[model samples]
Each structure stands twice: as C-alpha cells, then as structure tokens.
Target: MRDRGLDVLLVTDPANIYYLSGYDAYSFYVPQILAVTHDRDQPVWIGREQDLTCARETTWLDREHVLLYSDDYVDSELHPMEFVVDRLDEWELADGTIGVELDADYYTARAHQAFTAALPTGAAVEDATKLVNYCRMVKSEAEIEYHQRAAAISERAMEVGIETIGPGVRKCDAAAAVHEALYSGADGTGGDYPAIVPLMPAGEGTGSPHLTWTDEEYEAGEPVILELAGVVNRYHSPLTRTMFLGEPPAEAERAAAVIIDGLEAALDAVEPGVTAESVERAWREEIAGTTVEKESRIGYSTGIGYPPSWVEGSVSIRPGDETELRPNMVFHMIPGVWFDDYGIEISESFRVTEDGAEVLADVPRELIVKE
Candidate 1:
C-alpha cells in the first residue's frame, strides 16, 4: 500500500480477494470487499452476514478481522458500501488517499458512487485497476504445481471431448462427457469448475469462437472447435483443439498445419528477458505467406480465475505489448484462425522457463481427424 501511496485498498475482484486472503465462495454475486490498510497486518474481510461462516471457514482471517453487515444491506435501499464507509470511519482508515479497483468486473458504478460519496472530506479515491492482477503475473512453485495438475485434467477432458464428438452424437451429450472428465480429473487429483463453459462451435458456427453448444447433433464432414479449461484450486489451464468427424476439408488441414507451426514458433520464442511482443512477432513471421491470417491477440496470461474469464488480465502476448517474459509466468499460447465457414484452434498452455517454454499439457499438437 505504501508503494502506491494508498492508505487503504478496497479490493473487490474475487480472484484477487482469494489471492490475498484465501477467501473463496460464490458470495461475489453480491457486494464484498477486502480492505488492505497500512497499519493492519491482515486485510479485513467484509461481506454479507449470511457468508460470515463461509469467510470463517475459507479464510485465515481472525474473527475480529472478518466483519459482516446486516441482511438489510443486500439488494435494498441501504447499500453495502455505506456499511463499508462506517467501518472505515470506525477504523480511522478514511483519512488519506484510498485505492479502489475501479474497473473490476463486480465493482458496479452504484457501489463506486456510494463508497466515494460516503468517504470523509479530503479523502481521495484513486483508480488501482489491475494492481493486484499484475502482482499475480508471476507464479510461485505451489501455484505452478496447481497449474500443472489443471493441465493434466485439461488433457483428459480434451480427450473425452474429442472421443465423444461424432457424426451422430449430440453436442450437449459430448459437452457432458467433457465436463465429467474435467471434474473427475486425472491421477487422483480433483478438479474445480473452470472460469468459462465449454466453447463447442461446430459447422458454420466454427467461424465464431465464443459460441456455446446446443442440443443439435453433429453432422458428417464438419469441423468442431473445443475450447475448454481445467481448473484446480481456482488455477486454470486453457486448451483448444479442432476436430473433424470424417474426411476434413483441404483448406482446414492446411490452416491447421500453419497454426501448429506458428504456435511452435511462438512457444520456442518464450524465455526470460524477452518481450511479449517478440513471441508474437515470431508467429507472424512464420505464417507471413499463409492464407490464414489472425487479427486478434494469440494468447494471454492465465491463472487463478473466477467466473466469466480465465485470463489474469496481465501481459498479453501480442504485437506492441512490451511486457517482459519472466520465468514462472504462465501463458496460454493459442494461435487460432477463422475463415468464412471454418476455424482451426490448436493451443498450448505453457510456462516461461529459464531455458525456454515448458509446455504443460501432453496432448498431441495437431489436427485430429476421426473417420
């Protein structure tokens, strides 16, 4: 807090709260904040009264450090930030500049307005967006271990997804099998729910990457894209692959080759002291003459995610990004390309090592053709 000149930091991002206090629950659907003050050794955990037991059980916070507001503050005229303002007054933490995650997913405008308006006179509110996320860019050994376990589950789930998807199989049924494999985990390690649902875009929908599956059955000679992640203890390892039920189109095969080659080139470029954009440049150079062209960023930092996204919101691997690649930083190098009717996505989740990139999953890095 001193480094940023923040007297108190009001953290609302669930993943960041989990990182700081080990406080985990579905309670992020409502108002909750972790208060980091300059004087306190532990960050204060503030939430609804109903989740008090959840905070006690999940967090290492002392009883006094974990505070809860009355039920009247939820979804009513009385906002939870008003209670937060009262606590700040009681603790005398509102006398200086306060930092808030202004751009967090769950930090609503109403909450911001309430909190800022209720603060004491002369107390400044500054934007500390992604501050905690940047702190999480580099993973520790334990965190890396969790990511490796998640990668194992990802490989298993992807195998199930590919095997279950066929000409006559329903897309929902295939998604179910993939989910089972993800939750069941591999090598006796249990899995956690991923930040994103299975993205199974098939046939013409393959051109759009973010489309989810429906009850529709698979058709012959069509491409299906499976984008999924395996989460272990909230850490995520995302994986994407393209499959064909029968004989695949020649264009798709060619694109797959280009993507795989470019992905390898990008992975090979990962090392300490290298800029993130350097890796992207390698991929672009490898596919310069190919018909497949990608405009979106290929990959991003991944770990310790919550609902809606697995990206860590730091260090994107793309052109013009100058973030330095440090050892132990993990990234999902996904170089996917889409055409008018079909798309190909073959990705790898890797960790930057002192030597080079350490690919996490053991899945075959190629297009899978099933007859």
Candidate 2:
C-alpha cells in the first residue's frame, strides 16, 4: 500500500482476499472485498451476509473485522459497494486514497463503477491489481513446502493417468482416475481442488492447449496431452506430459525431445536477477534448429489460488516480459509445441533460488509410449 501510495487498499480478487485474510468460501460469484488500511493490523474481510459464517470459521480475522452486506442486496439492482462505502465511513477510511484491483476477475466493470462512485469525494481509486500479485510472486519457506506437497500429489496423479489411459479406454474413466489421484493427495496428506480441471486434449485435439475431455474412446497411434495440477492447501504444482497408445512416429518423438530440451533451457535461465523474457529467449534459442516452434508463452508464476484459475498472473516466461526473477519465486515452465496434427508438452514447476532453479518433481521428462 505504501509503495502504491494507497492509504487504504480494497481488494476484490477472491485469491487476493484468501491470501490476505484466509476468507475461504466459494462466495465470490457475488461481490466481495478485503479492506486494508495503514492503521489496522488486520484487514477486514467483507462479503455477502450469508458468507460471513464461512469467513468466521475459515479466516483468521476477528468477527469485528468481518463485515457483511444484506442478502437482499444481491441478485437485485442494488450493489454491495454501498455497504462497502458504509464500512469505509464506519472505519474512518472513507476519505482515504484507496487502491482497488481493477483487473481482477471478480472485480467486474459494474462493481468498479459502483464502488468508485460511492467513495468519498476527496478519495481516489487507483489501479493496483498488479501490486498485490507482484507482492505474491516470491514464495516463503512455508509456501514452498506446500508446493512440494502439491508436487508430490501431481506426480502420483500423472501416474494414475498413465496407468488408466490406453486404446479403447473411455476418456471419462481416465479423467475419473486422474481426479481420484489429484484429490486423494499423497502419503496420507489430503489434497485440495486444483484451480483447473483435468485438461486431456487428445488425438487431433492435442494441439489445442485448454480442451477438456469427452466420452470418446482412446485410439491407437494417437497422442493424449495431460496437463494437471496437484493442489495442497490451495498451493498448486501443475505438471504436464504426453502419452501415446502405440509407437509414436519418429517426428513425434523428436518433438518431445525438443520440448524437453527447450524446457530445460528455460529452467536453467530462471536464476535470480534474470528477465522473464530471457527465459523464453533461451528456450527459443535452444529449439532454433529443431522443426518445433511455439508462439505462445512457455510459463508463468504459480501458487496460492482459487476456482476459475491457479495462475498467479504476475509474471510470464515469454518474449517482451521484463519482470526480473528473485529467490523463492516459483514458475511452471511449459516449453510445449503444437503441430497441425498433434502437440507435445512436458513441463516443470521450479523455484528460483539464489544459485539456480530447483525443479519440484522427479517425473520422467520424455513422452510415454505403450504398445
């Protein structure tokens, strides 16, 4: 807040709200805001009146700091910003220059307009979405531990996918196995829901990055791309790999090699003080002579997230992004390449240390093939 010249900050992003105050409930489909001021040690968690019970049970905040607007305010023309304005007045922060997350997923245009108009006349609303995300870039020791746990779950989940997926196997059955492994956690440690569902873009659809599965049966000689995350306490370690039901073509095998090499190159460039784009540039340079090429970003920051997505959205490992790396920063580097017929993706979630990057898992890097 001080760096952004914000006397008070109004955070509407559910991820940020959970990060700041531990207010965990899927209550963000409606409007919610976490208020932070220079004067208070604990930020106030505000949301729909019905969600207050969840906030009380989940958050670390005292009930006095958990404010709620009436349920009547929702699903009506009435905006919850009016109650936020009331709280600002009650807390004596009504006239302060407040920073709001204008770019956040939950902070809609209507909400922004409604809240901005209700603030006191002298007060200002500034775009500070990046501010919180930037602060969240570097992981603490505890956060890294959670990530390691999530990584463990991710490895087991990948194994389940590989075991259950084959020619004539129903894609839904494979997806079900994956979900079991994901939420079952590892070593008796229970897991949480990942920000994204199992993305198993298969056969001709392998080239598409975000396609979900259907009831179609797997076919021989077809490639299946598995992009999944293992979540622990909301921390994610997303992992991806390609599997083939039969002997993959020589070209497909070569593309997998290129993907792995490029990903390693990017990971090697992820030490402290390096630029984000430099990582992508390294991957591109590594694959220059190869037939594989990708125009999309290879990676982004990851950790501490909610439904809708797990990408922290602060930084990206791609061209034109100049965000510098620092120790304890985590990233999921995916040097995936897509051809007209298929795609090959092998990714790693690593942490930036002072010396080098620490790859989070020991999973096999090559495309798995089964006859």
Candidate 3:
C-alpha cells in the first residue's frame, strides 16, 4: 500500500490476489502483478486478457496491462521478461523504488528478476509483502459476510455428518455425505480448502491425527473422530467432532469432557487485545495434566480463505503482531486432545464484536451420539 512508504506493491500469491482484488481464479500459468498506490490514478494491474475480465468485473483496478505468451512459455522455452520491460517503459515507471513480495512463486521470481534487470538505473526491487499481509489481517465488511455464509454451510454439513454416523457407514461415505450437504447449501464452488473429508480414524486408526478415511466398518463402542469443513463460495470453516458408533468406552467419555473443557477455555480467551500466545496458554491450562499432546496453534483468524489469518511476518506469537482485535475480525478455534487410540476434539467459528464475540455457527458442541 502507498501509505506503507512503498510506491507500488507487486502481489504474486493467489491468496493475496483474492484479498486485494476479488479475483480468485486459478490462472497461475499467466503472471500477474497488482500495482497499488494511495492515488487511485496510479494503481494498475499486469496480467493476461482472460484474467483481466475477472479483475475488471469484481475489482477496482485503475489500469491493466495484458501480456501474450506462447506454449514455450510454459515449458521454459520463451521468457516474459522483455514484455514486462516494455510495459514499465510505457508506464514511465522507471524512477520509483519497486517493491515485490518476498514469498513469490518460482515463476514469479523469474519474472521479478527480469523486471529488475530490464528497469532503468534508479529503480530498486524491495520486499513489501509483509506490509500487504498486515493490511489483510483485518477483515472488511464484505469479507465477513462471505465467511459468515461459509460458517453457516459448514455447520449444516457437520450436523448432517453427525446424523449419518451409524453402523455400516464407510469413512469416505461419511465424508461424501458432508460434501454433498455443503455443496447443495452453498453457491456452487469449492471452498478455500478441502471440505467434507472426514479424517475418521476408527478402531486402531484413531491414534494418529493424520489418518485418512477408508472403507473400515463402524463397530460397536468404537470411537470415530470426524474432521471436516464445508466450502461455501470459496470460503471455509474447519471443525472436528468425535462420537460413538454405539456407546464409547468410559475412558473415551472422560477424555471427551476434558477436551470440551479445553476448547471452551480457549474460546473464552478470544477477546479484543488478546494475544495468540495467551489463547494457546488457556487451552494448555485446562489440559495441564491430561495425556494429550498439543501440536499447532490453538486458533487463527479466518476470512475468505482458511489459514487466511496467518501471524504474517513472524513465527513466534509475540507482540510484533500488533494485530489488535478490531471488531468484525473472524477466527476459527480448533482446540483438540490426542488420547491413545481415540482423539477428542471440538471446533467452531466466531466473529469479534463490540461487546465480545458472536458465534456464527449454530452447530451443537456436545458429544454427538448416533444410535
């Protein structure tokens, strides 16, 4: 952004494109750079003609520069370096320091190197994606509306998944059930991430969190862990719930209670001015003596895309994340527990509000039992 002291920002990441412009098509074959400045007149875009149509329809780009490439471009036969140079020369952008995202894809890096080499003497290539990501941390009004609808679809799919969990149901079948439910309820687009795929580890598979679905039959008293999400218009809501095919063992029941308690504790910590570290600590405090092993962060910000709210710039969840919990910020809390052959888990979506936070999904968090 121009306010961040950069004259122009070159965005190569797909998610970044979706964040800035509402362009979410899969056109990686064609290179794209979004030039942004505080002055609307100076803002521009560089991409292929097909992509330009989508950008023009949903976005507010001041100008767009299209490039034509041959089949050799894909196989590394022809490079697009010269094409960008002529455009820069025509735009008279040979003076200001140019900033490119550090995390550009390999193809984007090649194009960036070409641009730098071809530019006039004074132009400099700098990294400015951190600033762009910081801007994306906070959700806009339209972004929140997309996420709310996604969460609603995810909740309905989850409910359908819970109800379909009887004997003789294959893990993949259950995952399929969830997919169908969400797709029917949604506006006909795959979510930001894979939706309705139950990583159900039944019987011995329950011990590993990374286990995928199989044709394994549901047995009496066997714990079935269902991890799934529903994709609604390219947005996602992740959730995981465990239930008994018949009646779970007493030990599993106790673990479920502990996991639910931990989940609630983490959810309670999600208020304005709260730190990511503090949120994770709340879950640990609840499961202090429990046998479960915690792995990832307790939760993350959610918007149009899953994992869209990354800590942005740093790995440690420390103060540099001055990501103040502004109202309208959305988050997905996945507080889980790993206990021997069975895992206990709970998940939900929430939006930060003035008073506190609003729960977007109405799905019940109680231990779901399918008879």
Candidate 4:
C-alpha cells in the first residue's frame, strides 16, 4: 500500500470489507466504508448503529474507532465535504493522498467528492482497490483452511447431486438434495452461511454455463449438468458436474471425455511462473480438435468469499495478466464442453502448490451414470 503512494485505503465494497476485516453484514442496502492507513494496520469501520454489534464482534476495530450513524442517516445523504472533514478531524490526518476502491458504488464516490471538497488545502485521492485486491489474490493460511472446509462440504453435496441425476428426479429436486447435503455440514461442523442452491440443468439448458435449476425433469440416458457450490463460513467453493440418468448418450459421453481431458491439460500447465492466460491456452489447445465450442479464458482466482472471482466484469482474465501463479493461490478450473445438443461440465477447486496445483475437492470428473 505504501508503494502505491497512498496515505490511507478506504474499502466500501462489502465483499472487500469482509475479506479485509471479516465483518459480514447482511444489510448491504446501505454503504459501509473501511478506512486503513497506508501501513495497513487497524482498519476503521464506519457503518450503521444497527451493525455496531457485528462490527465489534466480527472486525478488529477498536470500540472507539467503529463509527456508526442511525438508520435515518443515509450514507448517500452525507455531504461529501463534511464527511471528509469529519474523518480528517477524527483521525488527525494531515495533508496526504487518500485512496479508495474504484468499484465502490455511488456512495463511495460521494465520500470521495466530500473529501475533494475538504481538500485539506493540498491532499490527493487515488484508487487503491486494485492494490488491495492484488494482495488478496494470494490465500492466507486461515483463508485456505476456510476454503478447504467449504470444498469438503461441496464434495459431499456433489455426491448427493450425482445420485439425484436418475430419471425420476427433477432439476429442482436435485438442487434441493445437494442443498440439504451441504447444509448437513461435513465433519459435523456447521456453516455460517446459507446452503447453496445448485443449478441442475439438462440437454439444451446446459448451453447456458450459468443456468439455474428449473422445473426441467431428467429423462433416462439424458445428460444432466449441475453447477454446485457450498457457501460456508461466508466463503464458497463451486464445482460443476455432468452425468447421465443411466448410460450417457453417445454425444454426451464424448463431450464429457473431451472436457475431462481439457481440465487435466489446464491443471498440468499451472505452475508458479505461469500466467492465468497460459493456463487457459493449455486448456484451449486440448480442445482444438474437438467439436465443442470453447471460450477463450477458462478459470479464475478463488477466495473465502462466495464467488471471489468474476467471469466477465472489471476482473481481467487473459494470458498477459501479469498476476503470476503462486503457491497457495486457489482457483477454479470449471471448463465445460457443449456439442450438438449434449453438454457436460466438470469442475474442481485447486490450490497452487510448490510443485503444481493440488485439487481441493475429491469429486471425480468422470461421467457418473447413476442407475
């Protein structure tokens, strides 16, 4: 953070706040901001009075530093200049460059406007979210442990999901089965977050990679695709699997074989020096001769928060992404292939190891045809 020429880093995005401070507030309808000095020690949380208990319990904030306003005090209504002046007075901050998250919503921008108004005679503001996120890309020991537990629950849920793929089961029913399995909690440890509701789709429904469970029914010998995640401890590990009610139809079987092979090819390419794009390229090369349509980028970095990464958004996902793969870096390689009317998705969570990548979940990638 010091290298970024920042005096303080302000985090207004709730997910980013949870990542840094461990304060998971349910009321995302309003805005919450975290102010941390460039030294990156002791983040001060400014939020609603209703969240005072949550701030005190979940965050490392000192009681005096956790500022709260009443429910009537809408953050958006705060004058940008007055809010900045107050924070400067409270923190005894001198003239220096303040930093904030660029992706932070309009409320954060309003805060920035207020700060600019105060200006403190000669101060600057810069976007520090990228720098903070770059630090978050690598997993800490505690973060990895949370993900491991989440992944284990997700694996158990996958087992139930696979079993529910037979003809009599509906997509909604399959999702419910997986949800119940994950909610049961693996190793008898309960979760802090809600159980995941999987999206179990079949046939044409599988064309949409992010499809949700509907009233679709699974027919014998039809391909069934499930995108499952277990949200635990405010973190999640999502995995995808495709199966057949009985034996996989010829087209589905072939697509699954190709997808499984591509996933292996991608995993084999993951190493400390490898770029995200290179890993994706490796997967694409494996499917070059296959008939299935393929997207360029294959996967993303993973973390404790649900959906720590995005497929299409401000998050970059290309080969030149200089973010080198490092040990303890978790990622999801969820590559699925669709051919004709058949689709199969095989995915797993992985943590980059000293030598290569280690699979976090034990769910098999093979086409499991339940009888």
How do the residues 225-280 of candidate 4 rate in per-residue lDDT, one tens digit apiece? 87766666666677888777677677767777888888899899888887778887
Over the stretch 160-183, how does candidate 3's per-residue lDDT look in tens digits?
Answer: 888876788776787678777776
RMSD to native for every prediction? Answer: 0.9, 1.3, 4.0, 3.3
Candidate 2: lDDT of 36? 90
Q: Which tens-of-lDDT digit does each residue in 41-85 have in candidate 1? A: 899999999999899899999999999999998989889998998
TM-score of each candidate structure, all chains considered together = 0.98, 0.97, 0.80, 0.86
Which candidate leads the pack in lDDT? 1
- The local distance difference test score of each candidate is 0.92, 0.88, 0.64, 0.71
Ordering by lDDT: 1, 2, 4, 3
What count of clashes does model 4 give? 3
Report the Cα lDDT for residue 45, model 1: 95
Off by over 4 Å in 2: none
lDDT of 2: 0.88
Per-residue lDDT of 18-70 in model 2, one digit per residue for the tens? 88888877778999889998888899888888787899888999988988888
Give the worst 10-residue stretch by lDDT in candidate 3: 310-319
Clashing pairs in 4: 80-114, 81-114, 277-319
